[model samples]
Target chain A: MQFIEDANKQALEIMQTAQPTLVGMGIAKDVVPGMHKKLVMHAGPPITWDKMSGPLRGAVIGGLIYEGLAQTPEEAETLAASGEIEFDPCHHHNAVGPMAGVVTASMPVFIIENKTQGNFAYCTQNEGLGQVLRFGAYGPEVVEHLKWMEKTLYPILKEALEIHGPIDLKNLIAQSVQMGDEVHNRNKATTSLFIREMASSIVKTNSSREDQVKVFDFLNSNDHFALNLSMPAAKATMDPVGKVKHSTVVYTMCGNGTEFGVRVAALGDRWFTAPAEIIDGLYFPGYSMDDANPDIGDSCITETMGIGGFSMATAPAIVQF
Target chain B: MQFIEDANKQALEIMQTAQPTLVGMGIAKDVVPGMHKKLVMHAGPPITWDKMSGPLRGAVIGGLIYEGLAQTPEEAETLAASGEIEFDPCHHHNAVGPMAGVVTASMPVFIIENKTQGNFAYCTQNEGLGQVLRFGAYGPEVVEHLKWMEKTLYPILKEALEIHGPIDLKNLIAQSVQMGDEVHNRNKATTSLFIREMASSIVKTNSSREDQVKVFDFLNSNDHFALNLSMPAAKATMDPVGKVKHSTVVYTMCGNGTEFGVRVAALGDRWFTAPAEIIDGLYFPGYSMDDANPDIGDSCITETMGIGGFSMATAPAIVQF
Candidate 1:
């Protein structure tokens, strides 16, 4: 009982005092420590190429192409078959992602720091929707958008941040929760707030008005722009509370397309696994449950941090969806 | 009954469609459309100099010094005694303020436009706490802060805004309501969100790092910076809903320190007034209820807009107060 009380105290301290901030934007390899060539970060827990689902496999192929190691899906498939590309869980690298959560070396990642604890976490930028790398479709359009985000969006945000400095994201997330964002799945308020805060910086930092316009249009058009930042922000805050010796609290909740996995604090990094469930929700036009993938991605970090599914009552907007 | 339903319909349309945007910032004269020398804008419904409260009188005298029309409080008092400065309600000029809401010609005002209705509203920037003009303190320090806001803070925001472009404030306000801000006295979320949104533009547009630091420090330090903007945003949204024929719905609620006033939609700007109530709440250190002024300013616009005190149940943080 005493141990339980002490663990609760430690968890409370992390939850109450952790200050997560949006420090900057960077590519995975440069920002993520110890990221080596041919290494890929996927969603959920550790899984091999053979155990990978269709979408996960597709994402791995997409990641290979994104990293310029493969030009064609067929070549990428050959490499995956040969076990040349090393696949790893994003959590292993102190990173997380959505869907297949394939993060390659060159992919742009949101850098979130837990200022209170002096630790950091990373997540790849959300690719909006439809035929994107996270969802496993890597068409030419996906490739183009990724390249544009790297070349155009990255530099503008980088320069703007240089002028603006770091943003206290935990404060924002808490406020956003009050404003109608569950901080997972429903992020309309946070995204708009993000746009409002960064719009001017993006404009003044960019020498060209066209770039500013493009950046503004892109950010506003995508409601999920803050999701990437929110994910890592959650991780940065929760990381401190994790790994307690006898804490019964769940630290990490995620999926690798094929299975749902969670890391219990008492069990250290040992993952408790379950079979993945089919996502039961409204789908896009012309798409049905048949086309839907299993619940995948590291997004359950929100739930782990106590706001997503765990606090659905507070965010009825997302619950309705 | 039919007329009442129609008025409600109109009110709903305004509340639903009114898209207020923070278009720009400028001097009261430049932004308020009509201007003449010696005119002053105060909070709430109209009142003569003889009927004004102690704080109202002090703010008026401060305005004189701020405008360089008078050098001392005694001289400003004489000018007021002589009726040389014409005082009018800020609402009459399509503007609003909190407390002793005095707006001189040279005072900097946030310019908000209802993009949907194609109308504008204005409010002076919050002077922050302490010996400030809004609370009726016209000391040299107060005068100095107002001048610095005009000379430094105003221009930096202006340039950053020019680079950033118009902000959809209506969306932000709605989101703020969801986030725990009643959009009246508790605007912490909106203010932080505003800071996050504007920090970068402020950084990039300003040539001096020190100036950028000052602007950031000033804005970040003052949680009420967005309060002024929020009032005008509310007014802009509610204005079109106002003045409907034969409707009992309240359109504007405000106070002039001495009296509380409400404008019904059917009244068409005809204010229904009552003796002001003494503010009963937690006071600053060394101050008691007797030292506090009557409930004042155009802040009750939030209640008229259906948040503020009306929806305190949704914002428990404020309800606790």
Candidate 2:
């Protein structure tokens, strides 16, 4: 008991003192350890192709098309079932993603480093709401947008970050929290703050004005843009706790569409999993409980770090939504 | 008395309904009526060169050098004293500027239009704090910076405004008031909000990335950048009240470094003046009351519109400064 208490205290200290800085960005294959061309990472615990849910399957198919591995949904499905493509959890590769979080090798990711622990975490950019790859819409428009993000958004932000140096995530988050952002469901303030902070450097990059404008417009319109950064920041913060031997603190909590899973500090890579439950929350127009997918995404990492739903009172505006 | 009360009601209604929109920008000589190559507009009521305060005189010299009419301070002083040059108040040409408020022929000025009144008001861009033209430091660096603003900053913002259409100042000010900005001495929130609003369009301009970045960097670093806009908006808002018959409202208040002046509605263009009072507020480091300049600039236009210091309670954070 004494050993467990001490380990928990150590884990708590690590979490409390973690300094997550958004260091830079890179293509997944180039930066994420063990990422490969044929490898695909999804949110939550690992699942075989046959067990994957609709949204997850849709995202994977979209990712394949976006990656140029397959031209059509039918072809993507066949290749996925052929076992030639390897599927793994984003968590296994020091990454986290949101709903149907399918990340392929070519996707751009934010590289967040936790200075206190000298560890890093990664996450892909958020493709704002409605008919997006995250929600499993693999349309041509979605693929084109993703291409634009890779071609235009990625390099501009990368260069801007170079100019801006590493931005302290802890400080940004603290400021946003005070400004009425839960940093998960309500990131409007966080996104605005980020835009304000990056506008100067972003304009300085070599990107053409047309491209720069596109980036600014995209970020301005997407209130959820900072969610990706916040997720990786949480992931980086919690990763050190995983190494605290004898600590029983829950370090990761995420759900694939088919199942919910969590990992404890002392459990050492073992996941405690159960059947995922359907969300009993508000739905968009023309949708109801019957159309709802089961609980999903590594977004719960925000709640795991005591924000998001854990601190809903900080963002009263989210209640209306 | 009844006629005056009715006129006052009309003036109040006009002020309440005034919609000042930032329409565009142009050179003062080209857009401001009565502006000429040899005419220099200063703040407050008109004064001869001999009576001008030290800061006002310094700004006049800097304006001459900036306009290329003189090569040195001595040449500038000779030109000012030679009767060949003209000195007038910015208020005479529907303009307002801060501090010494010197407007030269080629200086860029924001064109703020009161849509309801179909009249326009103009103000030069704020040069930010210390050792600048507004505070009357006319070093080579100041002249060079002023040139950069005319050549680089003006076109980018002008094109961006063309793309952005008209920005409604009333709505922007309302939003900023809620965010702890007095829109005068504290324009941090207003500037940030303006940057967030304009960034998308600014990036879309035809300017080179280097130039665009310079513009963004300039705006981002200058927390008082929006002060210029607010002053012109206030001027535009109060200008309509000046046309009301028999109204006793005090609509215009400004100061040259040498004297403070006020204009009353229904009294036409008559200016009542007194020797300017020295500011008894906080001083910057290495300065004291003994070194203080008299109360100066067109900044008090914000106070005239019932914000600025008039509504200081709305911006409690300004007290710390």
What lDDT is obtained when candidate 2 is compared to the true structure?
Answer: 0.88
Q: Residue A63 deviation, candidate 2, in Å?
A: 1.9
**Tens digits of per-residue lDDT for model 1, B66-85:** 99989999999889878788
What residue pairs are clashing in model 2? none
- In terms of DockQ, which candidate is strongest? 2
Q: Please give, as one word, the docking class of candidate 1.
A: incorrect
- Interface RMSD value for candidate 2, one decimal? 2.4
User: By lDDT, who's the top model here?
Assistant: 2
- Model 2 lDDT per residue over B38-72, tens place: 99999888889999999999999999999999999
Candidate 2 per-residue lDDT over residues A109-203, each given as its tens digit: 99999998899999998887667898888999999989988888999999999999999999888766755568888776567768888998998
Off by over 4 Å in 2: A1-16, A44-54, A75-88, A171-182, A185-210, A242-295, A303-321, B1-13, B44-52, B78-87, B171-181, B189-209, B245-250, B258-283, B286-290, B306-321
Error of 2 at A316 (Å): 9.0
Lowest lDDT sum, 10 consecutive residues, model 2 chain B, at B312-321
